[model samples]
Target chain A: MNGEAPFVPDERDRALMLATQEGLPLAVRPYHALAERLGWAPEEVFARLARLHAVGVIRRIAAAPNHYALGYVANGMSVWDVDDERVDELGQWLAAQGEVSHCYRRPRALPLWRYNLFAMFHARERAEVERAVAVAAVRLAACFPGAVRAHEVLFSSRILKKTGVRLDF
Target chain B: MRERRPATLDDLDRQLLWALQDDLPLCERPFAVLATGLGVSEEEVLQRLRRYLAEGIVTRFGPFFQVERMGGAFCLAAMAVPEERFDEVTVAVGAFPQVAHNYRREHALNMWFVLAATRPEGIVETARAIENAVSLPVWLFPKEREYFVRLRLRP
Candidate 1:
């Protein structure tokens, strides 16, 4: 645990985050409908969400989809080792790729964990993901010789869960 | 030093969440569909969702879109925030509108956050902002391999 921050959500705040995370009700007056059920006034429910957003508790209220249903059948986690100085530059370049959904750098395990830069390539199949990785590897290796050392491709075996914040109140 | 209380779930709530876990209807009147399926009024369906949300049993209930489908740039990044500055660094990193969710996990590089940008530049700009705000080297750990694991809590 990082330096523990005291962030005990009040009952109302907790409810708001839960609702935002779970799913906003499909109603014309969604806030009002939700408020009516929670035994609170609609104004209060709306106000609380606004407040949470202001305080950064609830990041953004949006809808996502089940990707597999949409034909994106394959996902690959790709890792790379790039020059420390150019990691940001290369990361930005890789992030630009439409097929690459996720890109970031993680602390590498000394000696063993030499790779730092990571990009997640997703496509309709393993071959598509591999092709994307191949192109990216070539583009990245051209800049930093011996900088891009190793890469690993881990395919998703199963999806345990995809829901946001665990509500344990 | 302290007592740990176990969380409990009732059958109906479990049923409601289980119904929503995977196949949330996508339509103009999704509640109508849910109501018909559950043999309850649309208001009753809404009420159960409200109760679940209030109880903190479900964090979010809505469409889980594939980011790639929507033409967005997203990545999960982690930084080795020094123990002393962890709080400050997290706050700084969380300030970015582009950041979706951040968590503190048990690892040397503790602070982790997800960045979703409408444009590619937004990702780098966010990293720069975080680095400048925290006054520490913000390591961008993008996803190398994506294991799509659908996690569902069994009641």
Candidate 2:
């Protein structure tokens, strides 16, 4: 997923994005509402969105829940020092789990940082998250014995800031 | 920060949140489509969504863009600010528009943040600017590969 090619949005697409980048309209017929604003046919609006989604530009149109507000108080970033030869395999296995929110293979900053696999887990309690991590570790060991050397779960204490990504264009 | 009781959601709320985790249909009335699936009226769905947004339960409702596909880049970076200057350094770090989500975690590298930039080089440039401003070395961990990224969460 990190090797995705570039997609330069043309003028029309740019205009379409600029119109709804803040958010999709809340009206009963949001596409039609957007069409009215953009002075384009409702069909065109839907078509553009469909095309963007098909090409991987837009991942999806959905509600992003505030985990903390929804009672997911424990946010742990579980990092693992797995075999470099099979880190990707381990990452895929971990990422497929329902509890792993985000998983990726990152570079290790050695000595101080030897973990290359990062998986984020969220739960209502710290203990629950810890247990989940332990279970994952055990399962990983079973899948590939001696593959994982060490792991640690870093729990976030506070959210200093969390404004979602924004693009001027 | 305001504290809300954990697991206070009713069944309807849970169902609605779970339903929304899937990709919303690209139709004239996306919410209406979702409402039908949940056996509720379009108006009710909209009302609940509005309430959730107003109450801070839902942070955002819209398209989830893959910035990398749009010629942008994001990196997870960390800094270890001294105990005495954590607050001051946080303000300095937050000043950057590229710094997206910043979190305070318990570790030697206590401060972790994600930087989103229009181009790949922008991430490095922003990190350097942050280092100069905070007078601390910022360690970046760019993803070599993404196994999976769940855009939505079920509470």
Candidate 3:
């Protein structure tokens, strides 16, 4: 996904990220061009890309459209508290959810922040976001017998320096 | 932060945008690949891309990486600021180089920010520094597992 789990990119992964991060070339065989630049076989580069994409290391080889332009003006980083033991299944479900663009099972900072499950919900407006949050909350509550403890939809009133996270090694 | 503006799209622009998202083609002269698919010229494809970049319609025209794999740490953090100190604290938090994103949200934890740091420890260090600077408790929520993270907006 976006800010995926913590892990060090191998030399090869670093090479790929660095070489292609500046936008792939506008050539017939862009990967072939990438191969030529990296001094590796075009086929090898293609295979590596396929592998990385499969493993979620490379989310997609696509254009990240401006969400605001796409009508999702108001987006909320919806965080929830659920029994940690029961989060895996719920997180997986949320990941597959059409609206939950990004889903993660983060560690809980108890007493202060008990939200172990974070799902990003986007919509054209705040009310839509609240409705989506309510839907997801209901589903999560079903999975967990205990009170959700806290469900907060942090609707960003302002945004600063938003961009895709990169591995710039 | 960016303002919400209407991004007018022509049929050609929409076609080109779709092509760019669908795997930038894995062939020689990839733009030509897209051009051929859209029944346009390779030069036209290149021109459109340049314009899109210049116009800020396309923020990035490349592969998006899994940041953590590249030896970086990203986290969602927040602080509850007094109404009087909201702007002051927002400026203070925005000053950190690692603060990739800071937002004003409506909730108890009103001030929210995303931190992308070179090292895992850097996230904690920055959080602590911000907490001390604003004299408020900073709650750090580091991602333990990523279930899904794809933002596909079909034009």
Best candidate according to DockQ? 2
lDDT at position A156, candidate 3: 75
Model 2 docking tier (incorrect/acceptable/medium/high):
medium
Model 1 in CAPRI terms: which quality?
incorrect
The per-residue C-alpha lDDT of model 2 at residue B110 equals 97
Docking class of 3: acceptable
Q: Write the per-residue lDDT of candidate 2 for residues A71-134, one digit (tens) a residue.
A: 8888999999999999989999999877788999999997889999999998879999999999
Q: State the local distance difference test value for candidate 1.
A: 0.59
A15-130 per-residue lDDT for model 1 (tens digits) = 66556555676574566667877889877876776665544444444333334432455767677777777777777888777787756666675643577877767776779988
Which model is ahead, 1 or 2, in terms of TM-score? Answer: 2
Q: Which stretches of candidate 1 lie over 4 Å from their true place?
A: A1-11, A110-112, A167-169, B1-60, B63-155
Query: Residue-pair clashes per candidate, as listed?
Result: 35, 0, 12
True contacts kept of each: 0.08, 0.75, 0.67
Ranking by lDDT: 2, 3, 1
Worst 10 residues of 3 chain A by lDDT: A160-169
Q: All models: lDDT?
A: 0.59, 0.85, 0.74
Output the lDDT of residue B29, model 1.
Answer: 59
Query: What are the TM-scores, per candidate, against the unseen true structure?
Result: 0.51, 0.91, 0.75
lDDT of 3 by residue, A8-97 (tens): 556886687778866776555678878999999888788777777766566577676666665567888888787667778778877776
